[model samples]
Target chain A: MKIGYLGPKGTFTEEAAIKLKKFEKCKLLSFDSIVEVLDAVDKNKIDKGVVPIENSIEGSVGITLDLLAFEYNLCIYREIIIPINHCLITNKGVKLSDIEVICSHPHSLAQCRKFIEKLGLKIRSFQSTAAAAKFIKGKLNYAAIAPKRAAKLYNLHVIQENIQDYKNNFTRFIVVAKRDHEFTGDDKTSIVFSLEDKPGRLYEVLKEFAKRNINLTKIESRPLKLGLGRYIFFLDFEGHRKENKIVDVLDAVSKKTHFMKILGSYPISKIYESNSLKK
Target chain B: MKIGYLGPKGTFTEEAAIKLKKFEKCKLLSFDSIVEVLDAVDKNKIDKGVVPIENSIEGSVGITLDLLAFEYNLCIYREIIIPINHCLITNKGVKLSDIEVICSHPHSLAQCRKFIEKLGLKIRSFQSTAAAAKFIKGKLNYAAIAPKRAAKLYNLHVIQENIQDYKNNFTRFIVVAKRDHEFTGDDKTSIVFSLEDKPGRLYEVLKEFAKRNINLTKIESRPLKLGLGRYIFFLDFEGHRKENKIVDVLDAVSKKTHFMKILGSYPISKIYESNSLKK
Candidate 1:
């Protein structure tokens, strides 16, 4: 099997892809951007592609949600949740006190804002955390905020571990393919819909799930770009698409929406057991 | 009056601030970051702070929402919606064919991506659009994606206007102060709350507004940072807290959520009338 991921290697996405590889041995391919990986998956160039869906701290990855909603017809085959343990990495023998500059992706920098502020250092943003890790190779005065694995891969020493301001940081990734997975008892169904401009339509539509005792896992609203107050909602609920209750709920909800699209139904992630090893 | 804005000057936030200044004269002080501006308002260092709350294309600004939900005690006093018109700015006498590089904030770069890609120039990122405009001064080969106002402020020339990928882009800014505005008859209220982890708690809370025929303008769910599937909801509805129906809705809704905070109530923006001249 062939699987693609967003990478130049040594990214959290790659780590998630590697974990997915154990379920079934597959050749892992790295793509430059998230769109490229999803596009490759959609065109059958790769069997499946792994990309981040949401972060515990950052909330949902808007581009991923938007693409899955409007641009792609792909289905989520599996879900993976990984801890985002940012480490302070520097060149060998470099001390934390000697570092005058910090570098990382903007999100990583934002996540570690409190730590950086206390350190009183200048910040530089790289396109990716892995790139920042690689860039600090011979720069003794620069420390990077990246995953610990990147430190080992890039031959850098980790000066401090788990430097993110919040200890509970985690990113949820999804494997997308042309078609979704079959019934998995413990699964989640993702869907997006736009309610007619009538007040309370959202409340009425959500009642279908509530009345059926279907628990919602996530809910997000994105502007349709038509204007403010105009929105399309994306939701994830605890059920497989093949389940009878899910079918009934979708039918009821669809009737109340101007339009609806089922993005996917996939098993809930259980990667914390293995991710603990890295932490 | 003293007001704070996220700026180095010549930014969209400053543009929003200038529009606000028309209603009542105020001295606009520039801050390095969103947190600083909001923090200043919380400490009463400034009478008010103007910060971007949401973009029509980018959705909600997570930092702004997170701060209001968790850290700060300030209340939103007004709402300002302005059209985001990106321009291709360069030094005077520079031709389109002479440009070899493009520079701007990441968000601005992403918004004008298609235009830049068509031009096939190397991209550079700056801390802000205003900074990028300043950096390209006297460099004929470099073009910056910024607001036209910046071009005038920095004595640059606009080679092209409205270069964003989408034409419907708009950003909503909020004026935050120690106290919220008195009801203007036509106003909107914002609130954030966490539901009590029940399967249907959200539906029940939303029903309070639905039953009263109250219209919701925006609904967003952010991760509580406690764990996956845990969320704190931020909502804006079309009524002031002073309204009888709004008071009843808040009372009913508060009884359902584990915790709740009323962010503010203020007049909705109608800045399109004034912003059209800039567009």
Candidate 2:
């Protein structure tokens, strides 16, 4: 088996990919961007790909969601949730006062805004936190906000641990493949659909799930980009598409919606169990 | 009067602030971050603040949304929508082939991803697109993805215009103040609320508006971050809160909700009129 992920190694996406039981014996490949990973999967360059979908604090990763919605013909095969802890790391002999600028992925910088502001240092954004750590090697007057593991891998000293604004920060990642997963008893069906521009069309569509007692796990709307006030909704519900009840609800919804696409049906992630070892 | 906007000047937020009819004769202040802009408004440091809320291509600005939901007591007074156009700017006499690195705000970079990838240049993220243009001053082998105004403001040459992936890209900006606006004939009411963890609670809440023939313009759910699968929804619908029909709907929803906040009702924006001259 071959699996692709966003990396230069030591990224949160890499950590999530490693924790997957099925990928334990698979060959791991690293790509520079999420778009590349998904493109590789769509073109069969790799068997599967893992990418971050959303962060508890950062909300949706727009690139990931947009790719799945319009650009890629892929389905989510599994989900992974990992707790995020950012650290401020510098060269072994460097003191905090020596740092003139801090570097990290833009999201990491945003998450550590409070701490970064307190330090009053200039910020430079890199492609990833891990990339930021690697960039600061042998460089003077520079530090990075990255995962704690990055400090060990890059031979840097940690100035501070858990510097993110929120302690419960977590990121959700999804494994995408050409084929969708089968029912796993405990599953989530993800779909993106556009409603007709009538009053209460969304409310009417929600009734399909609500009347069937299908609980929604997530709901997000993205602009259609045709104009203002136009949107397409991405929904996650607590049932597999293969389930009879869910199929019935979808069939009814198909009649009401202008367009609908089922991204996948995959098992819901068991959080803490796979993450316990990391702590 | 004084208006606060995300700035270093030459940002989309700054443009939005300048277009406001109420702020035509008012002084405008630029802040480093959206949080700071809102904080200034909350503390009466500015009479009003303009911040980007959503983009046609990028979706919601999570930081802006999160700040309004928590840590602040402010109401949206007006909305401004402006079409976004990115330009590839470089030092005078520099050819496109001379560029070795490209810099811009992450969203600007992402919007021009195809162009940047085609050129095979290294990308550096800046706090704002305008900041990236300013950084390349007297520098060689660097190009910036910024607004066309930045090229003229910073004495750079526009190598290519409208380099973004989408031609119709637009951003929606909101003017926030200490108090809400009075009803205009045409208005939009924006609210954020949390529902009880019941299966049909969301449906029950939507019915409050739907039964009254009210139209919903937007609906987005952000994780409460208390745990997995918890969410707080931000909704925009037609009709002012002062209307009897809308007031009754709010009363019904307040009862079904665990927490509710009315961000405010304000007049819908007229697009293109203010943006026509910028083109």
Candidate 3:
């Protein structure tokens, strides 16, 4: 098996991918962007792809969500939730005062805002936190906010561990494949749909799930990109798409919606409970 | 009167500020961050502050939403929706082949992904699109994806205009003040609340508005940042908070929510119709 992820390596996505039991013996490949990872899966360059869908502090990863909704004909096969512990890394012997610039992915930088502000250092954004660590590995007077594993991979020293403003920072990653997963007892059905321009359209749609007591885990609206106030609703509900209740809800919703697409039905991820970095 | 905006000048926020008739004679102040802009308004350093609340393509500005929900005591006085047109700016005599790096705010870069991908240029993120233009003002080989006004403001030439992937891209900016505005009958009330974790909790919240036939323009869920799956919902509905129906809904929602905050009720923004880059 071959699995692709967003990386130059040492990213949290890679960490999550490695934790999956099925991919223990699989060859892992890294792509620069989430789009590329999904494309690889679609093109069969890789058997599956792992990309971040949401961050606890940063909310949804829009690019990932958008690609799943419109660009790729892919389905989420599984999910992995990893605790995000951002570490401040720098070249050996580089002290706090020597660091003039800190670089990381924008989300990581934002999560570590308090630490960055306290240091009064300038911020630069890189494609990914691991990429920032790789760039700053042998450099002096530059630091990176990256996963702790990045420090070791990039031969940098951890100047500070768990530097994010919030201690419970976590990112949820989803494995995407060309086909949807078979129904598990505990699963999530993700769907995207657009409603007609009318009052109470969304309420009517939500009522389908509510009346059936089918709980929704998440609901997000993205602009349809046609114009202002035009939106496409993305929803995650607590059931597999094949389930009778879910099928009925989708059938009812489809009749009311202008357009609807089922992204996938996948088993919900178990949260990472270990505080230690090792799995 | 003085208006604070996210700027080092030539930002879309400044354009929105200038369009406001009431701020015609007001001195405009530029702050480096959204937090600073809101802080200035809270401390009376500026009478009002203009900040981007959402982009039609990019969705909600999470920082702005989070601040309104937890940090500041300010209310949204009005909203401004501006069409976002991205321009590729470069030094005079520089050709596309000479461009090595493209810089802009992350959102601007993402909006122009198709154009940038075609060019295959390296991307660098700045604090704002205007700042990227300002930084690349006299530099050779570096181009910026910024508002057309920034090209003129920074003495750079527009290599390309309307470079955003979507032609109808727009950003919604909110004017936050220390107090709320009087209802204009055509007003929007924005509120944030967290429901008790249970099945049908959000459904219950929406029923309150639906039963009254109140229309919700937007609904977004952001993680409370404490952990995954714990979310605070931000809702925008078509009624002023002062209305009897709205007041009753709030009373009912308050009882169901673990926490609740009324950001404000303000007149909805009139979309800027002219496309000539002039107010």
Candidate No. with top DockQ: 1
What's model 2's lDDT at A261?
92
Q: Write the per-residue lDDT of candidate 2 for residues A1-279, one digit (tens) a residue.
A: 889999978788888888765446788899999999999999999999999998887778889988998888899999999888788999999998999999999888988888888989999999998999999998879999988778888999898888888766888999999988889899999999998889898888899999999999888888786766788889899999999999999999899999999999999987633332263
Model 2 Cα displacement at A95 (Å)?
3.7
lDDT of 2 at A130: 92
Better of 1 and 2 by DockQ: 1
Please give the range of 10 consecutive residues that has the lowest summed lDDT in model 2 chain A. A270-279
lDDT string for model 3 (B90-110, tens) is 999999899999999998888
lDDT of 3 by residue, A19-108 (tens): 765436788899999888998999999999999999999899999988888788899888889888888999999999999999999999
In model 2, the runs with Cα more than 4 Å from the true position are A21-24, A272-279, B21-24, B273-279
**Chain A TM-score of model 1 versus the true structure?**
0.96
Better of 2 and 3 by DockQ: 3
The lDDT per prediction is: 0.88, 0.87, 0.87
Q: List DockQ for all candidates.
A: 0.69, 0.67, 0.69
Q: Output the lDDT of residue A154, model 1.
A: 95
Tens digits of per-residue lDDT, candidate 2, B1-279, equal 889999978777777888875446789899998988999998888999999998887788888888999779899999999888788999999998899999899989988888898889999989998899999987789999988778877888898988988766988999999887899889999999998888888889999888888898889888786665678899999989999989999999999999999999999887743342354
CA lDDT, candidate 2, residue A251: 97
Counting clashing residue pairs in each candidate, in order, gives 0, 0, 0
Q: Please provide, for model 1 over B34-130, each residue's C-alpha lDDT reduced to its tens digit, 9 standing for 90 to 100.
A: 9999989888899999999988877888889998998988899999999898999999999999999999987788777668768888888777899
Chain A accuracy as TM-score for every candidate: 0.96, 0.95, 0.95
